[model samples]
Target: MIRPATREEYPHLVDIWLRASRQAHPFIDEACWRARADDMALRRLPACEVQVLEAGRRVIGFYAMHDDHLEALFVDPEVQSFGHGSGLMAHAMTGHSSITLWVYSRNVRAVSFYRRLGFSIVDEREDPETGEPESLMAWSR
Candidate 1:
């Protein structure tokens, strides 16, 4: 089930973000993820509108968005390919006519996932933080 993330679940959500980020972004240095984990926990997640996918009592995935821009979407690596991401994405798009996000170009799986969901690549640029290529994608209702 998808629902708004609760403040009490913040730590779990941060752990998921770190784990997913480390697992999916191999091309990037691991230390980078470790460093940002704190920021994601204390800053990003709290600042965004986040929704979580819960399976009974456990949170398996989540997506964070602000306005029409999706800032984060992370699913536990153990639960990938099980439609949790798709579920959260559908929920995220509920009240918005359009949504936009940035994905690392080298994260092929994520790029494909977004593509399959009808989000088209609208631009490409280097991510300043990691100095890696990234693509901007958008889906319009």
Candidate 2:
């Protein structure tokens, strides 16, 4: 079932981010992980607005939406490739005509996932800070 997440979930969410450290480009240092965690932790999110993918009482994944844009999506590694990410995305799209997101070019898994969801690359540009290349993708309902 999908439901809202409580404040207590932040730590677990941070842990998930750590687990996904593999998402960073190859040859990247741990500083990138720390920076990601710091940024995500300090991010301002609307209260009670995070959507969680839960099974009974256990939270298996989470996603956040900022207006029509999907700001974040994370599924536990143990449950990845089991439709958790797709389910979260579909849930987020229910009320929106379209969604846009940025995927790091080196993150092959996410690029493929977004493509499979019918999100096409609308633009390609370098990330200003890290100078990493990224693709901007959009999906229209």
Tens-digit per-residue lDDT, 1-141, candidate 1: 888999889899989998999899999999998889879888988899989999988999999998899999999999998888888888888778999999999999999999999999999999999999999999998
Number of the top candidate by lDDT?
Answer: 1
**TM-score of every prediction relative to native:** 0.97, 0.88
Which residue pairs of candidate 2 clash? Answer: none
Residue 76 C-alpha lDDT in model 1 = 95
- Candidate 1: list runs displaced more than 4 Å: none
lDDT of each: 0.92, 0.79
Give the range of the ten consecutive residues with the poorest summed lDDT in model 1.
87-96
Per-residue lDDT for 1-141 in model 2, tens only? 998877778778777756665554554566777777756756734432588888868788888777777777888777778898999999988868999888888888889999999999999999886788889999997
Per-candidate clash tally: 0, 0
Compared with the true structure, the alpha-carbon lDDT of candidate 2 equals: 0.79
